[model samples]
Target: MNMQRSMLAVLLASTIAMPAISAEQGGINAEQGITTAIPMPVANNAEADAQLSAEELAKQQAAEQAQKQLEAIIGASGLEGLGEQARNLAQQVLNETQAPLGFQYDVVDRLTPLWAPVALQNTLASALASLDDQQRELLQSTLNSRRLQNARSKELSAIADQDNRNYQDYISRLRQQPPAPARVALIKQLDEAMQFSALLSVTRSSVYPQLQAVLRNWQPPQDWQAGLQRDVTEFLLYVHRTTPNDELQRLAQAYREPVLQQWLAGVKKSLSRQAG
Candidate 1:
């Protein structure tokens, strides 16, 4: 009975050990399969990432190259100089007897000194001159208008300078005045004009309309009547010099006082006559 019990115990131990060994073998097979599959997926992902990075880098380099080329062109040939050349070309065209042909050849010859690469200069001249008769006329008209406008601007600048000196003199006198309300108002007006003039000289035409809007709705500081007259005078002078007739008329209409409105109308008429 004792021998049979010992043998049964040994049999149970072998059965348990067999299952443990089988489980170990199964685990080793699973680990090997995972290790082999992992590298292929990882390598594919790395290759895809590298390709995408290369494409993005290429796009960035292309954009930078385009920007550099544009800068080079603009630096070598300035817009203002080109505009002057166009103006000169238009004048030459006007003086030529031949309707179009002589003017075209003359422009090409004149611009050769200004633009490098004689071929490019000639090409541009021919392209510009190839416009239809109506387009040519329109270009001529615009050029003529610009020339006249530049002349008028010089004249207006001289007038404005003289007026500014007079305004400064007025301010000096007002400072010596006996504390009058009108004198105070005039000082304020002069200050506003000075500020507006600086803006007009530097800012673009598109922004000038917005300035007029603000000026139209502006109100004088309260209890400062004596210091505001100069300010009003300066503001009006600036508007007369810079603002168009249509805008000035609109401003005149917006003012409640009939006298101020009439004054603004007179200013518009004066500007028109001067421009003409």
Candidate 2:
């Protein structure tokens, strides 16, 4: 009985091994009289290799494009000279000087009332010019106090700050995420909001009267009561009209970066959301 059981186990093992052995050694189909091996699927590593190659090539191309753009920007900025010290100094000076001009331009653009009446323009100019330094300070302080007291200034400030914060947050978030089609749509929405906030920030600066004073080169006239509104108005207008767009363009190029773009987009989106 033990011998019979051993024989049965052997038979079972042999039955399982038969198909595997035949697959390796091939066989003849007796009825068809044909011999064939068991077919196995071939792995097409070539396709994977090609895909990897394509991705590598794309990355290389993108790197080259970014390098070229950086070179072009540097060349245009007049920083092509090889003198390291000179380049550093030049960059430093530009950074210091250009920032204020850009900010001023932005503020002037957003807040300055459109179309100052010829008569009122003159009155404003003359009033600014006729004040003593002490009187000017007092008047400025009073105006500032009044603006702070007004709901408009506080509301605008709150809105601008919130938009700026939103813009910054979105940009930070995007930097970590993988690129996708949805990002493009989101970016566009953000860009518009950024522009709106920029404009709003300028408007909220409340620099219109101060700008007029500076343009007027205000001085206490021989006749204290007299106003030189027209002259002051003309200067303010001239400053507004003649403020070059070139500086803003250059600054835009200088500050261009993916993060900045994202931030800009975010600001824009925030403003749009508020508006809607």
Candidate 3:
């Protein structure tokens, strides 16, 4: 797939925030996958680890904390229980439905700087992590409760997934058929809750310099940023297509809690610094 077509896939089954559960919940968490499954594993550089500059170390710590924050949000969001009920049902839903998105990992691996997603993921996590314990619990409870309330909605999360295939074929048509102004407003709120543009900008900033460091001959396409932004907006729109307006409003507002915004700003500052 071409890069633009695959921009939607960077979401990696997490249109919300890719919020993996943190270690406090358990050792077996998705955070492990982020560090391990990255296209270029930074964990492999043992020798380089020791020599990190203070600035690099700070960024690393910020990234780690952000990751923990993300995991915290994801883990708490699960229904409280030791049994399968506690096993992040939302994550399961995403994993199952992501297949239709054309998960273009190859494209993500090739063009974007290796650290970009790592940074982005952690930035999102940090924003999520910023919420206080009570707020976090509220966020978790709200999601599960709303979802259960509308259990009547057939595959509520899966509706958008079905319409996600034929990436190229759908983009033009999708753009032409713009969402209603109300939907657009909600989407903008959703982006704010998630710190979508801020984190996106943060990653976009480092991409070129980092790429130059590793791939001297590499040059990014001019339209790459615009394309990715469009995909992100559309992907989120698709996910929420079947969600009830009231529930969707609450969901977006949950993340916009003052605490999340505060954390979002902190991570943005930290991630703005280069890892190297």
Clashes of each: 21, 11, 3
Off by over 4 Å in 3: 1-71, 74-170, 274-276
User: Model 1, 164-242: lDDT tens per residue?
Assistant: 6765665465446534455434433433422322222221122222222333443223443333334434434432444
TM-score of each: 0.20, 0.19, 0.46
Write the candidate numbers in order of decreasing TM-score.
Answer: 3, 1, 2
Error of 2 at 78 (Å): 0.4
Tell me which residue pairs clash in candidate 3: 20-71, 21-71, 22-71
Cα lDDT of all candidates, in order? 0.35, 0.32, 0.49
Which model is ahead, 1 or 2, in terms of TM-score?
A: 1
- Which tens-of-lDDT digit does each residue in 10-35 have in candidate 3? 33223334544433321223355745
Lowest summed lDDT across 10 adjacent residues in model 3 is found at: 79-88
Model 2: C-alpha RMSD to truth? 34.4
Query: What TM-score does model 3 achieve against the real structure?
Result: 0.46
Q: Highest lDDT among the candidates is held by which one?
A: 3
